[model samples]
Target: MKKPKQKKTKEIRTSLLRRLAFLDRATLDIDARTVELAFSSEQPVSRWWGEEI
Candidate 1:
């Protein structure tokens, strides 16, 4: 079976470097993290919560 083609980190970094005039090095990296989306009125949400205001 053929392997699925996914966007690589180098490709993304190179693309960003090319688009931004000031950005030259391809040292950019992406970090994916799971975030909590629950909201509470009585308690404050965590700092890492993406859905919290």
Candidate 2:
């Protein structure tokens, strides 16, 4: 019996130096946690409860 041929796969990987280069290219000074807090506090839960009361 003949063995079946296996397919080859290509793997792509980013090096640590390349990742650091990307971080250095970013210019934004915004804090992710601060933005999350701002959005969460802006929701309508308080306003809805105020209208209900």
Clashing pairs in 2: none
Per-model lDDT? 0.44, 0.43
Clashes of each: 0, 0
lDDT score for residue 34 of model 2: 28
Best by TM-score: 2
What does the lDDT read for residue 10 in candidate 1?
53
Model 2 Cα lDDT, one tens digit per residue, 1-53 = 99999999999785665212223324454665222211123334445348322
- Candidate 1 lDDT tens digits, 1-53: 99899976654333433222343234443354333343335544457555453
List where candidate 2 sits over 4 angstroms from the true fold. Answer: 14-53
Q: State model 2's lDDT.
A: 0.43
For model 2 the local lDDT of residue 26 reads 48
User: What is the TM-score (0 to 1) of candidate 2?
Assistant: 0.21
Rate residue 47 of model 2 by lDDT.
Answer: 56
Best by lDDT, which number? 1
